[model samples]
Structures are given as structure tokens and as C-alpha cells.
Target chain A: MVSKLKTSLAALGLSTALATSMVSGAFAAAHETPLTGDLVIFSDMSNPAPRAVMEGMVARFKEMNPDLNIELTIIDREAYKTQIRNFLTANSPDVANWYAGNRMAPYVDAGLFEDISDVWEGDMSENLASTKGALTIDGKQYGVPYTYYQWGVYYRKDIYDQYGLSEPEDWETLKSNCQTLLDNGVKCFTIGTKFLWTAAGWFDYLNMRTNGFDYHMKLTAGEIPWTDEGVKKTFANWRELIDMGAYIDNHTAYSWQEALPFMLNGEAAAYLMGNFAVAPMREGGLTDDQLDYYQFPTITPDTPKGEDAPTDTFHIPSSAKNKENAKAFLKFVTSAENQTLINAGDALGQLPVNAQSSVDDDKFLKEGFDVLSNKAPGGIAQFFDRDAPAEMAKVAMEGFQEFMVRPDNIDRILDRLENARERIYK
Target chain B: MTQATLPDTHADRGKRSFWRRNQIAISPWLFLAPGVIFFLIYVIFPVFQSFQISTLRWDGLGDPEYIGLENYRELWDDPAFYVSLKNNVLWLLLYLLAIPAGLFIALFLNQTVTGIRLYKSLFFFPFVISQVVVGLVFTWFYDPTFGLLNVMLGWFGLGPINVLGDPTYVTYGIIAAGLWPQTAYCMILYLTGLNGVNPEQIEAGRLDNARGWRMLWHIIIPQLKPATFIAFVVTIIGALRSFDLISVMTNGGPFGESRVLSFYMFEVALSEYGFRMGYGAAIAVVLFLIMLIFIAYFLWSMYRETRGR
Candidate 1:
């Protein structure tokens, strides 16, 4: 009788376990089975708007195609360059962000990036044309540029008002403003070169305003010498500003984000940075009416002007598990409506690549559009460190810092940069 | 009588041969498999690949051009190479100070008292946190304007000295940060050793009027030799492999002033600054060789001690 009871208890336990497993399976089936394959996208932008827009698109894509899944990883900008290279070797992301210039050359050569020339020819010609060959290397398009922002001097209008100064249009006027601010016990400029990339903005703006677009391309492509006289003159101009006590101390110890307090407290008069500084300005309690943008002051009268507007681009990796799904998502991302949603968001202060799209009516963006549309003749992207190899850039920025602290060492600085260029390029 | 003798001899021979065959088959494998597999996977295979690649000029991607010895030749002229080597030596020399300082602390806290156990644990706390956190803490502490050290100096009307910004003091500042956790680690090792030291010996020394420095040098230190040796070995390796502190604090900066060999190797191979993988491997090989010299000395000492035992 005891053995029969034990047998019945065992049967009951087995049935209960079977029922639980079956129930879980039924529930899983009932849940919307989105895409089942894998897609990985790597990006450097960590702001909420871009993430929201991209996540929404991923969900939509997953719902439309129930055999695919997507994972998006955001790397901090400083570490992305090194970390991305490591990722490419073993398990490359299906799609990833890469720079558009000679920076992509190394990866493209290694077959790390997929050759999407066919994608451009068939589906993305408009996207290709709008980016102006920025994502093309060796007559082949490897990536699609999704966002870009103009770089320039962002200044406090209240300080300009207190000093009876208007936004300077040329080098002479800019120098005069700096002197005036110095005389009035206000720091003329604020910069944080702690990570060293922020210094590139100033250099790019100065170079673009001095040399034309062709020279900028030549510099980026490693065709021009680092010790060129035009470059030297830019350094000399920067030195003059530094000598006049134009910049804040301990700049080396602070990131650009950390310098917000200086501007919020009215300790520093201006910041030379990308349009993305608008978010920080708002975060620091500065209303749009308080902050304003001006073209970086002209350095040469006849120089071809260029906008130092850095851009972000997406590339399909060669190692993607599901290339078709990734390409489909890429198509979805570049669709006109999606581009509009992305541009209207807070993550990127980018104007729409699609000319016909309606941008969100923000005053700051309207002002940005006005500046971009009416930009100086022969406007091109800024070409300081981005134009140079990363190795040369590291040495060159350090040289800039040294020159800032000790203006007399300009000759040594130029020589060292030239030496670095030679060593790095070879 | 001859048949009986032959059968006995054959039985004895068969038994002896069976045992011998089994021993031969098993003993060789038992000695070889663990060490050979481990060496192949962890050390030998990787070293061979690194050596093969050091002859090829590859940017870590694409087809590598077999340019033999070119990377090593380039290393001869690389100034940053020398700077990193010098910084590494400095790291080693200064890092050794943690050993004696740790021993000093262990002696001080060896006495029994209320809350003494908590005191020992509190002293060991820095070692528990990661090197990355320690680097950040020190970076903030060495900030010229806002750092604790500078603020204290300002109270005395002395310094707003740029500890990290100036290339001169940058490496020293990083070394000071590294020492914080490293000293804590050594202190714990010594504390454990002190707890196990013969109390009867201490009492006997006290009877002989041997106390303080004389007692420590002649009696205590000799007894703690194994702990001292282990402490020295770990500190040496930690100092030589000092990468995280440099990376987190300065990124080998103020114009690459604080770069040790390991960070320099990484920057050369994979950083945005460059991707000379061959050159980086060459640097690694050089570092490995330097480390091997010390490792050989350690092994030889261990061998002699064991053999004597």
C-alpha cells in the first residue's frame, strides 16, 4: 500500500512539472515574437534623444521582421577609437559609427567595414550627395553620415553688452574684443584641453579661416607639410591671444563639461566649441537669449572659409551575422521621416540631411540654420587634428599646449610637429 | 626438476614485466600533460605568434607585409621608447619603498588592544578598492586648485603647485597614488606573518633586554623572511605592470611624461595615436626579457632553498 502511494506521488510531481513547462512555452509564444536574429550597432553619442529614436526604430524593425534582433552599444567618445578597433577583430558589430575622413582608410583597407557602394548607387544617392563625399574612401562609400554640427565661438551676449562689444567678424575686431575683456578683468576665452580633443576646435577654426578648402583636404590627406607657413601663422595668432591673458588657468585639468561653471558664473567670456554646447548652456541655467554664436573670426581676407562641422557616420561591419536585416535597418534609419525625427531630437544639434524635412521649431536651431545657409564663400569642414593622423595629432596638441604656456617656443613647437608627422606617416 | 624450475622463473618474469610496462606508460604522461598544455596555451603559443608578427608590418588588419626586423630597427630611434623605459625604472625604484613602510606599520599595530582588529582592517582598506578608483582619487587630490594637498598647502601660504600639470612632478604624483594601495597590501601580508611569529621568542628576547630596533632587525625580520620574500615579489611585479594608474590618471600625458613601458606598448599598438602592432610586440618582448631576468633569480633562490631542505 505504501509503495502504491509513493508511485502515485511521483506521477503527480511529474505531471505538475510538465504542466509548468508547457505553460511557460505557451506564454512565450503569446508574447509578440519580434526579430530573432542578432544585430549590433556601436555609437559614441550617449544623449537620451538619439538613444530613444534609435531604440524606437529598432523596435519597429523587430516588429516588421520577426526573425531579427538588434543590440546597440554606446561607447564613450574618448575610448571609442581604441575600443572599436579591438571589437573589429573577433566579433565586429553589425553596424558601427566611424569618422568619414582618412580616419576610415585604415579600417576600410583591413576589410573591417563593408563596401556599401551598391547601397549608395541604388538606395542612398540622396544621402550620399548631401554628405558631400565625406563617407567615401578610394571611390567607394563605406559608411552613411547621419549627423553633423558646426564648430565656432559660443559667447555670452550679456558680457558683450556690458563691454559694448558686438560679435567680431574679423581677426582685428576679435583681438580688440579680447583686449577689451582683459582690460575689464574678464577672461577673454575658456578652454579645457584635458582630453586634448577640445583644442582641435580652435585649431580647425583658425586654419579654415586662414587657409582654403583645398589646403585643408591636403593637410588631412597627408599631402601638406606640418611646418607650412600658413599653419605657423595660426599658431602665432593663438600665441598672441595666450600672451594677452586671454585664457583661463587650470584648463588642462578640466573637461569642457567642467568649464560650464566658469561660464555660468560669468568668469569666462567665451567658449570655442561645437554647437552641442547648447545643451550644457541650457543645463547651466542659461536661457537661449543669453548665449549666442558667431562665425569664428576671419584670419585672412581672401581665404576660402570652411565650417569645422564634425560629423558621425554609420558603417556596416564585414563580420555582421545578418547583413540583410542590418541593411534594411540602415535604409529605415536614412528614410526621410526618421532623419527628421533624429534631427529634431536633443542628442544632435544637426540640421536635416533631407532638405524637405520639417525641423522642430527651436529658436537656437533656426539661428544655426541661418548661419549654415548663409555661411562664407567656399565653406568647408575645419582641418586641424582631424585632418592629421592620430599620432601627429597627439604631438601637435601637446605642442599647442606648450606654445600656449610658453609663446617663445614656437620654433621648437613647429619643428617637433614636423618631426612627429614624419615619424608617424612613415 | 628442470620443468619445475623453468615454470617458476617464467611466472616471476611475467609479473615484473607487467608492473614495468604500466609505470612506463603512465608516469611520462603524468609528468608532461599539465605543464605542457598550460605552457602551450598561456605562454609558448602566444609568444610564437607575437614573434612571427613582429616581422610583419600590419596595422592589426589587412594583409601584413613581411618586413623582417624593420620594427625592431625603428625602435632604435623612437624617443618615446626611451622615455617610457626611464619612467618604468622610476616606478620600480619608488614602488619598493612600500615594503619597508608596510613592515613598519605591521610592527606598530602588532600590539593587542580594544578595537585593534578593526584598526588592522581599516589600514588594509585601500588595497580592497581597485587601482582605477585610487588613480581618480589621487588625480583629484593632486589638482592644483581644488585638491586636498594644495588646499592644505594654501593654508600655510605656500603652494598652489601643479602636481599633475607639470611634467616634472607628474610621474612622482602617480607613483604616490600607486603606493597607497600597494603599501596596504604589504601591510596585510606582514600583519598575518606577525600574528604567526613565535611569542615565546619575543618573551625570550625581552628577557635578554632585546627590544625595539635591535629585536626587530635580528629576531623578527629573520622570522618573517618568507613573508618578506613574497611581499618583495608581488611589489616588483605590481610596479613593473603599473598601467591602470597611468592610464586613468594622465593617459601617460603632460606630453607622455608619465608613460611606463606597458602603457607605451598599448599606445603604440592600438591607441588612436598609432597602430604599429609589430613595434608594440617588440616593446613587449623587451619588457618580457627584463622580467625574465628577475624571475630566473627568484626561481634559482627557491630551488636552492628547497634542495637544501
Candidate 2:
């Protein structure tokens, strides 16, 4: 009697499983287009402005799709960097915030990130043309970039006006400007290399200007050796700036934010920084008119100017439980309207990547859009750390920081970087 | 005492007798089981697992590839590894200075006086605040442009010393910052030890005219051996685990000059650099081995003491 009961119980369990699958299949077939499921997103939108924008977007998405349950988890940026790999493997979220270019390559290579080519083949193909190159690996698109901003020399207009200086257009003029600033008791630049990546802004611009964008990309991609003459020339030009006392004396002690005081006080003339610096500079008591943006002065005049444009993106992890809802969420978030919302949001003063998105009315944003669209050659290269393999980037940034601190050690630093590149890229 | 005073039935007496007969043999293992289980799970298992992981090329996500000793081979030529090892030695040697410094402070505050407790707690202020906060405070203090250290140095026409920037000075600067709290910790340990010193023995020493250095060296120090031993062990462990202050102050910067083994392992495993779990685990294994030497000696000495007792 017990054996007969057990057999009946097994049959009941199998039928229940079959019935649930059939019911879900019927439900899926009924609404083949509209998404209805739990959509979980993990983001490192810790910065207040971006966080607000993301929250707004999520609320709007919920309103649009009443059937979908959206769960948003905002983690601290630094913690997210480590936790992402773990979560992507174990308890993967449907959508996650990450960077584009080489920063996304490792996850893509490990098959941890989903290939969102179908989503890209839809509206994104036309809307996000420029950023597609950054998110593509092995001919498959993996992420959708939402925002990026331009990096250039942010200068004190008041200081430049007082010194009777023009924005340097080429290497020679830049040196002359440095000389004039130095003579007038102003340092040519102020940078905080304490975080290391700030120095990469200088390296990226110099390398791009000296050897052109292709060479810079090749070097960052580990195709060219650091000991190459093109690499050496970049350092040679950087050395001249060091010899001229162009930067703040003890830059290594300050982070990029900490170095802003020198420029605000007119002790230093310019800072090679991204557009995000403008908000902080304004908050530090500089007026809109007092601060002006200029492209990094031309180094090798004829080289295609490659500007640093670090793009932020979102992707679906391969292990996501709600793939359909994740695609819908990605589509909604990257819409031109939502992109414009993010642009106008108070926290993030960055430009949207969408072609049809409304531009921010801010002066710096206008200047950044103009520079990035008109001046940059073959579009923009992601900043150094974002463009290079992470291990190589870490060593390269350290090498740049060391060179800044002690220019005399350039050859040794280059050799050390080459060693790191071999180990990392291998 | 209450249990013994209570009346017992014959069956209860029999049960008590049985427990009394077997308790010596079974009780020790019962008491030790929880601690041993914890040690096996948290400490011992991880050490062996790290060794296993060091032999494989895992990225902490996918299947680990067995790569033999390739990670170690790579570490053999890794300049950063040597730099970290040298810094570790420097940290270990300089970190020992805390024990003496702590003992000095303890001696200074050992006397009875009004409001002495308040003063003692105030002296221990550095230990109370988290190390991360102390690190930030020191970073500001060492800031080249507007730091208090630079301002004071300017008064003497001396320094705009880029303490964190100069590789020659960065490690020392961080060690000094670490020493601030470490010294306070040692001071507390010594103070507790000082309190437990036999007053009658001190009275005997006083009657015999053994005072000051002689009293401290002969009569006092021998009694404080247990505290010294503890202080030595903790300081060594603290020195080996010196990651937070280095991470906060310099981040092994000015060309990776200030990296310690722990920070280097973290950089390899979890930083913006893609995770090289195998390589990082190899580094961890080496650090564990180095630490194991000290641990083995400690356990051996502890065993001898227990055996003698």
C-alpha cells in the first residue's frame, strides 16, 4: 500500500511540474511582446546626481510597465568593482552598470556579460553609433552606453586674461604660454596624482597628440611596446613640461579634487580634467565666466586629436533570470528622452550619448560637446584606464606618476611598464 | 557550593559519581571542540585552500585551470613582490619600536594622581579612533601645500617635504602613522601588566634600595614577561597586516615603493586590474608561510610553557 502511494505521489509531482511549465508557456505565448517579470538592476550610482537620475528613470520605467517588478540596488562604486564579479557569477542581476571599452572586455571574455546584439539591432543601432565600438568585442555587442563627457584643459580665464595669454594651439605656443605663466608667478598646471588615474589624462592626451590615435590605441591595447620610440617621444614631451616646472610642486600628495584649489586661487593656470570638474570648480567659488574649457593644446600638430571620453554603460549578465525584462529596461533607460533627463539631472552634469537627446544649457557642456564633436579625430578614445587592460593600466598609471615625480627615471619606468604589459597581456 | 549543600537522591548520587569518574577524560575535548572546529573552518582550511588555488590559474569566476607553479615562477621575477617584501621587513623591524614606546608611556602614567584615569584614556585616544581616520588625519598633516607639518617646517626655514611623494620617505611616513595607534595599544597592554605586578615584591625591592632602572630591569620586567610576549606577537601580526594605512596614505604610489605583501595581494586580486586569483593566492601563500614561521615559534613556546606548568 505504501509503495502504491509513493508511486502516485511521484506522478502528482511530475504532473505539477509539467502543468506549471505549460501555463507559463501559454502566458508567454499570449503576450509575446510585452515584458512581465521581476527586473533587478545593480548599479554604482553613489554620486548624488546620477543616483537621482537613475532613481527617476526606474520610477518612470515602473510607471511604463506596470506588470514588471523592478528592484534597484545601488552600491558604493569601489565596493561594486569587487562585488560585480561575484554577483555576476553567483546571484546575477538582470541589468548592471559598468564601463565600456577595455573595462568591459574581461567580463565579455569570461562570458559573464550577455550579448545584447538583438537589442542593439533595434533602435540602439541608429541611436548609439559612436559608443557601439566601445561595447563591441569579437564582433558581438555587449552593453549600451548612456553617457560620456569630454576631457580637456580647464583653465582660469581671469589668469589667462591677466597674463595676456591665448589658448595654446600647438606644442610651441603651449611652451611659450607655460613660460609666460611661469614668469608671471603662476604654475602652468595643477594636478593631483595621488589617485594615479588623474595622471593618465595627461598621458592619453600627450600620446594621442605625439603619435596619433592609432598608435595610442595600439600602445594601450598592448600591440606596441612601451620601449618604442613613439612611447619615448611622449615621455620626452612630458619631461619638457616637468623641466619647465609646469605642474604643481608636490602633486603626488593631492587627489584631483584636492588640486583644484591652486587653479581656483590663480596660483596655477590650468587643470587637465574632465567636464565633471566644472561643477566642483563653480562650487569652489568660481563663476561660469571665470572658468573656460580648451582642448589640450596641440602637440604634434598634424596628428588626429584623440580626446579622453570615458563612457558609462549598462549590461545584462549572462546569468540573469529575467532576460526579457532586462532588455526592455535597457531599451527604456537608453531612450533619447531618458538620456536627456539624465543630462538635465542636477547630479550628473555630463552630456548624453544619444544623438537626438536634448543638450544641457550649461556653458561647459556646450564647450565639451563642441570640442568632442568637432575637434576629436575618429571620435574619442576612452580614457587610459578604461582603454587598456586593467593590470596594464595600473602599472602604466604608476609609471606615469613616477615619471611626474622623477622625470629622470623615465627609461626605468618604461622598462617596468613593459614588463607589466607582457605579464598582463599574456 | 550550593549544589554540594543540596540534598541528593540515591539515583542522583550515582549519576554524579559516574560524571565525576569520566569528566577528566571527556571534558577537555568537549571544551576544545568548538574552538578547534572554528580554527579548522576559518583558518586552517583557508591556508590549505590558498595553497591549492596558488597552483591554479583562476580568475575567481570560471573553472580554475591547473597551472602548476607558474604563478610562483611569475612572482620570482616580479619587482613589485620584492618591493613589498622589503617593505614588509621594514615594517616588521620598525613596528617593534611600539612595544618599548608603549612600555615607556605606561610607566609614565603608572603613578597614582588625581584625574589620572582621564589622562590615561586621553593618552589612548589614537587607539580609540579607527585606523582609517588616523590615516586620513596623517595624510592631511603631511600634505605638501597646506599641511600643518609643512607649515611648522616653514617656521624653521626647512621643509615643504613631500613626505608621501618621495619614495624614500613614503614607507617611513606610513609606518610612523601606524606607530601612533600601535604604540597606544602596547601602552594599554603594559598598563594592565603593571597593575598586576606584586606590590609586596616592589616593597621588597624598595627596602633593598633597588629603585629606578635597577628596579624596573630586575624586579619589574621579569614579572611583565607575559605582557611583553603578547605585545611582541600582536605587533608582529599588526606589522604583517599593515594594509589599511598604506592603502589610505600612499596606495603604494610614487611608483609602487610603499607596497606591503598584503596590499600587493589585494591589488592583484581585487583592484581595477582584472582579478588574477591564482597569482594573488600565490602571493598570499608566500605571506602565510612567512607568518607561519612566527606562529610556529609562538605555538611551540606556548606548548613548552603549558607542559612545564
Candidate 3:
């Protein structure tokens, strides 16, 4: 028995010595490199291409740091929206995929997300200067943006060529273009409001163009009432489009994807959509030369031009266990080289957020980059949903959709939205 | 003295042996304890917890604040709430049509033909699939551009109707989709009930010159009371709980025109609107009360039937 105890004690001592050496080895490696721990990421990139891109990124990340471990749990988009709130508080992952702007406010306000300002101290701060404002809340940065895309009019260049029409520069030209398109037996615009947010794109552009960016911001922040005259003016402009039969008939029955055929078949002259719609349009047999990108026609000539640019961002959770590794991952992922790698991938059609990052020499990207990078009077507004609080955004979108369906009920819809705004802001 | 002592000892023995003699009765309760505990935890306890949650103001993430009856008061003023309530009434009224429709289908298919079994299985196919899938299939069928319904209507020069988009017709469209599966479920129940019908009574009614409607009313219908009772109960519950179809097809859209209580509760609690858990709980409590009234009546009727038997 004594001999057995001595043998066990020796074994224990040897194991402890080995463990100590391993710990020292890891610490030495950590000093040399910032990546040496397990990182868990919860992503909502459920689409096939985005999922593939994410998987590829993870593989490349693994190659960069052989010792670092990554656990990516990609969830469906709709499910992720609800599940994030639960997981962030109860079982937070080291990193999470989210949107920028007001969409990130609730989580940031609740302290569920970590402030990664130190990550933004050097190269990142310079590389991603344009996106810095979006991730900042209360003068503290909470996330890092990777990519964003511009929303604008994707018109049939061939149709415009056939009619000898130049891209509209202002509201009068836009109305005349619609008349020309209508006279030529083609719809002026095609949209699918079945998902509701598509209507918000129209509302965003109209409101920003008419009232400028400050008023749009104030309106979405619930500082301004929905019944405000500026809001009324925006609707009146939208009503002009409806009056001129700008959109396709029965648009509410189709999703944005389902509405693509109208533009592809030349039944509709243009689609006001994001850059992501370009690939689909090409796939549907519209050649690159046949389609051209243009900003939404100027509604009010002197109103500073505000464009919708929805940004996708990454953040570290406050309850993250491998925070150091997460920071390392964020830095690695948001690097100019890595951002270029993601931009080049087929999963995303959006431009890299890092100003220094290179993108594929694609035509639409060049046009979007030019338009978005230009000094517009009003600057950029994230899409309506991202700009406004989630509750207000939902009600606003519904109201917008209802207005599209029946423009006469604008008063009732605005009244309802005002009630919701008061209640939600209260 | 011995006799008196014996009588007292016998009484003491009787008292001690009572539980021992009733072990069979006690064992059943012991067996039921686990199920009862689970039911209380999962079903009964949550009902009361939701009621308590309704009196508070919570976002499901932050600390809950007590604001008694405010949520209910908000519900009173909410136009969306009224829309949901009105739609629910429409659903209840229209959803009942499935019962008679199911009986009609069951009676038509109640035959011993060579492929009748196959036919019955095919008829039951919709109920077997998930309602989510049914909603999708119906949504595609109602699509304005390429839907089969539109294509067919095109032939008649009648419609390219936006069935799921227009507020006036959206609820009816959803109800029609719901009825597809619900009718199939009811048909199966009636089919089983029909198999247990008394042949002797049927023959007696036939001999007395009763046939068709008369025969079915006096003989078959009376005997199908249990099946009808179960069908009504399930259909009512199903109508009240019609969330999946509405969620999949409309998501209470085209201006929240087709809102139902179950869908509204989910929208309020979960969705991108952020979690107004207390408000959602209040909506849930109202739905629960509505369901409770029907359930109470069902239980009372069931008790009466058993007591009379």
C-alpha cells in the first residue's frame, strides 16, 4: 500500500510539472502573438453565399493563428434577431454579428456589448474612418463595421438609351422621365412591398431629400412627431410617384426578389435597390452594360443629398470569456487585407468599409463608391430600420406600406404612427 | 373487563389498518404525482406567471417595473388590439365552416371501394404536413404575378386578385389556407367516429322509411355527438391559436389588417420591435381568458355527459 501511494504521488508530480511547462509555453506564445484562445461567434449569415464566405474566413483565420480555436454558430436571420437578446445576457459568445446605427443602440445601452475603442486606436481608426460614426454611441465605440452597400436607382440603361433619355438630375427631370417611361408602355418603377421594408427605402429617400438629413434623423429619433408637416411633405412627394403610376401594379403581393422579373423583362424601367440586386439582375440575363446605377433623383435641389447605406458590423460581447482572442479576431477580420478578401468573396456584393481595402474592379461597385464617397449635402442615413429604434421603425414601415396601398389614408396612418411613437419613446 | 379491553383494542386495530386496506387507491395517486407536477410546472404555473407579468412593465431584458393595469389600459386604446380582436372573431366564425365541410367529405369517402384506403390517406395528407409548409404553398398559389389562382383567373378574365395583400380579403385568404388542414383533421376524426356507428340502428331507421337527410339526422348524427363535441372543441382552440399561418403568409401586414391575438402577442414580445414582454403578457392573458371561457364550457359539458351516463 505504501509503495502504491508513492507511485501515485510520483505520477501526480510528473503531471503537474508537464502542465506547468505547457502553461509557460502558451504564455510565451501569447506574448509573441495575441491569438491563442477559443473564440465563439454567433452569426446571422444564414444565406448560402454568406455562410460559405464566413466558413472560408474562419479557415483563413485558423491558418493565420494555428493555436487559436473558432466556434462559429450561424443562425437563421429571423431566429437570430430574437435569440441574440437571450444569448447576450445568459450565454454570451465572444463575438457577434450585428448591424450598426440605432439597431445596435439597445444592446450598447444595456451594456451587453463591449466598448472596443482600443481596437480602434491605431490603423483601424484611420482605415475605417467613414464607418466610425455608425459604431459610436454616447461618444464610445461599440463595434467595427466590415461592409456596407449603397441604395439607389438601378435603371435599364438600354431602355434609357432607346428613349434618348439621360439620367435625371433633379425632381422635374425625374417626373418627366417617369412620363417618358409611362408613354413608352413601361412602368416607371418596380418595387415589392410584401416584406414592408422595401417601402421604407422609398420613404427614407423621399424624407431625406425633402427635409434633409437632420430632420430625417430627428424624425426617426422620435424627437419630431410623425404628424409634423415635414413628414407630410415627404408623403406628398411619394404621392406624386403613386399618382404618376411609378410602381408596378399589385406590388404588395411580391417580395423584392419576386419583383426582379419586371425590370429584367423591361416591363419596369428602374428599380430603387441596393448594390446586392446587381448580381441577381445579371443572373436574370440583364448584361452589365444594359443596367446602370444612379442616385434617387433630387427632390429638393439644395437639400443636402442623404443616401441610405446599411452597414454590417461585428462586436465583442461584454460577457465574452475569450475577450483577448475575440479582439485579436476582430482586428484580424477588419484588417485591410482581410476586408479585401471578404469583398472579393461571392457571398457579399457590398463594398469594404475600410477605406484602404481594395475591392474587385466591378462596374456597379465603382459607381456606388463614387456616389457614396462624394460630399453630399446631408451625408448618409442608414436604411430606415437601422436609423430608427426597432419599435418605431416597425410602425413607420407599416405606415409607409399602408400609405402605398392607399395614399388617401395617410392621415389615419400618420395618426396611428404618432400614437406608437409617443408610446415607444415614452 | 377483558371484553371491554378487547373492544378498545379492536377499534385501535381498525384505525391502524385503514391506509393499509386502501393501498390500491393510494397507489394510483402515487403514479399520477409526476404527471401532475409536470403539468403544474409547464402549463398551470406559467398561466399564473403570465397573469402576474401582465401587471408589470418589462422589456424581457431589463428589470421589470410594477405598473398595475397600465398594460391593460393601453390595450383598450390600441387600434391594433381592436383589429386583432375583430380578426379573431372573423376567424372563429368562419373557421367553424370546416366542421360541416369535414363531415361532408367524410360521408362522401365512407365507402369500401378498392382504392378507398388510399383515398382516405391522400385526404389526410394536408394535416400530416406542417402548417408552415401549407402557408407557404398557399402564399405561392395566391402570388399575384405567377400564382396558379391568377393564371386560372386569367382564363376567365375575372381576376389577378391580390388575395393576401388587400386588407379586405387577406383574412379570408388565410382562413381558407387554415381550413385546408383543419378540415382534413376534422374529416379523420369523423371517419373514425363513423366506423363505430351502430349498423342496427341505421337499418332500423331505413326500414322505417327514413333515408338520406332524414336517416342521417335521426340515426347517424345523434350517434356522432362525441365526435362533434371533440371536433368543435379542437376547431375552436385551433382557430384561437392560428399563429403559424398568419405569421408565415402575412406577418400581420398590409397595415396590420390581418392581425390575430396569437400573432400580435408574438410580435409584441419577440420581433425586431424589441421585447415588450409585459405588454405581450397582457395580450397573452386576454387570449388566455378568451380560451378559458370556451374550455370551461367544454369541461362543464363533458362533466355533465359523464355524470348523466
After aligning candidate 1 to the native by TM-score, how far in Å is the CA of A174 from where it should be?
2.0
Q: Of models 1 and 2, which has the larger TM-score?
A: 2
Per-residue CA lDDT of candidate 2, range A113-178, in tens?
A: 999998887546767877888999989999988899999989999889988988888999889999
RMSD of each: 11.0, 10.3, 9.1
| lDDT (10s digit) by residue, model 1, range A216-288 | 6666565777789888877778877888889887776667887767787788889988777888788888886
Quote the positional error of residue B19 for candidate 3 in Å: 6.1
Per-residue lDDT of candidate 3, residues A1-68 (tens digit):
33234333433444533343222222233346646779899999888667766776676677667888
Sort candidate 2 into its docking category: medium
DockQ of each: 0.35, 0.58, 0.63
TM-score of 1: 0.87
Tens-place lDDT per residue, model 3, B108-170, is 999999999999999999999999999999999998888999999999999689999899999
Question: Which runs in model 2 stand beyond 4 Å of their true positions?
Answer: A1-34, A345-347, B1-24
- Give native contacts recovered, as a fraction, per prediction: 0.45, 0.80, 0.73
| lDDT (Cα, 0-100) at A405 in candidate 1 | 61
> Residues B1-309, candidate 1, lDDT per residue (tens digit)?
465456664575555555453765888888999999999999988887888888888777777789898888877776678889899899989999999999999989989999998999999999999999999999899877578989999889986877877778889999999999999989989999998899899899999999889999988999999899999999999999899998888877766778988998898887887787888888888788888888998999899989999
Q: Tell me model 3's lDDT, rounded to 2 decimals.
A: 0.86
